[model samples]
Target: MFKNKKFECYLLKNRIPGVVLAVLMTVFMLMMAGRFELFNRLDSKTYRTLNEIESISNPYGSDVKITVDRADYLGYDYFVDSERQGSYYICQQDGRYAILLLKSNDDVVLNYTIKGRMISGGSEYSSIIDGITSDMGIAVAQLETRMYPLIISEVDFPRIYYNMMLLVLIVTVLWSVYVIVRCIYEVSCPWKVRSVRDVLGKRADRQTIRDIDSQLRYEMYYDQYGIAITDKYFVCHGMWHTDVVALDNIETFKKLRTSSNIGSGKKKIYKLLMVDVDGVTYEQDFRSEKDINEALSYLSDDKRVKR
Candidate 1:
């Protein structure tokens, strides 16, 4: 099967474009998955606490005094600004802001700003049902390209969304690999038949043959070579050489039937002839039903044929 047929012709005919498309798609999916994963992790519990802190504190005056026994921000230690001057304490090493969480009037108050839309800007009511549907919709959008501009509105900054994205990323990678391998397989397969002129320096006269139904044909297009029969030997001639099989050494013949273009109007039937001659196995495709029957008649006198 031509899993990569669409691009096979393109790839076989033009290598540059094929390789370029392959590389681009691979890179795009990887970057898309990576970026989405980063945003997804930003919605973790630590960042959730940060978002909550920002939501409560941004509305209050910057001069409001706040105190905290202990607070955690990205696993960093810090205190609320005592001077009512600096809104947050910046860690010297990582530069991550540790927002203050304080208990006031029996309600927790968060006093700092949380940066980035992925962390700060979604509604409070979270539902797994909505999240799944959102993931599917975004995954569909990402099938063609990972460009943020094209899918910005449909995108959701959730772990599930990135999980779906990772699935898409895996599928894209596998499909690309399949396409490349299939294309190589198809291209490397031998051509059906070679021209006589290429194998032989001179052009030979066309031969005539009779079918099993006694129909006469002036010209026959044998794939490899024309056939000639004699009382003592069955001769098959190719462009380069002739193959001679003695009648006494002939063995059983097999006819394998195969079909193509299934379920289509232009479907075709074909038969492969496998012959055993003097312990050597030879196989060839029969051009037509009549040709197959005629070829088998020479090899065996029996009316019955193996299917």
Candidate 2:
């Protein structure tokens, strides 16, 4: 049902990579959402007292929820290069005292420590718990002999899952939207007909329209890179741009060769330099000597060519 079969095929070929990437990212985002939901339902709600949490060997990596009835603020606070990451508190319940590491000073003293009991939410044992307690003179000795320490923070496993899912969801949604927009544009205006119309303007006659359409078809069928050479105009297509220069406006055309260092090797680059009557120079790179020579052959009859 498409008018230009070659242009339609080119659009489909170019869009495949983006479409595949959007699909894969969407699938991965869904998988992470499912995992996050499962973890939130199974792990985050189980709460234990300080004694039970301290009894577990290697509690460092495990996610634990604890209930605290009363806490005495230890004057000591933990900082990493002037930024406070945790605050120290002494929790005493049922004749048991354990050092608690909280995210903020307000979290330790607000409402619960001043008034009644509080359920400290899900927390992972801090890797730096030893460093935090080692410098507190008397409290260090008390923690070593009478009680163990627990590190609690606002960040937990379920939050981590939710954050990751949110990030992937944003990226997948943006990319999918971009791909859909591009597909719509390609279907509506194949062969960049809108660009050609803009270049020719409203008063363009039938012959000019036919010439531009013929040149575009020739470029799609035979042009190796994105360069199109016709008797009336020269067209260059780029990732984000399309340059159309009338043949009559050309001033100078020359071949250029240069050497470039690529990684550990040296490579030769070939290009065509065309300067318009207004002194605007357009340089386009070609893949090889043969390709550049073929493009040059199209301009053999033009008097602007510099040997």
lDDT (tens digit, per residue) of candidate 2 on 90-131? 676666666665655664453342211122323322323344
Q: How well does each candidate superpose onto the true structure, as a TM-score?
A: 0.27, 0.51
Candidate lDDT values, in order = 0.38, 0.60
lDDT of 1 at 167: 75
Error of 2 at 152 (Å): 12
| Deviation (Å) of 160 in candidate 1 | 3.4
Per-residue accuracy of model 1 over 146-241 as CA lDDT, tens digit each:
211110010122336445766777788887787677546534431211222222213211221112101112222222224655554344544333
C-alpha lDDT (0 to 100) for residue 288 of candidate 1: 73
Off by over 4 Å in 1: 1-156, 185-221, 224-251, 254-288, 294-307
Evaluate model 1: give its TM-score. Answer: 0.27
Error of 2 at 306 (Å): 1.3
Q: After superposition, how far is residue 141 of candidate 2 from its true place, in Å?
A: 27
Clashes of 2: 0
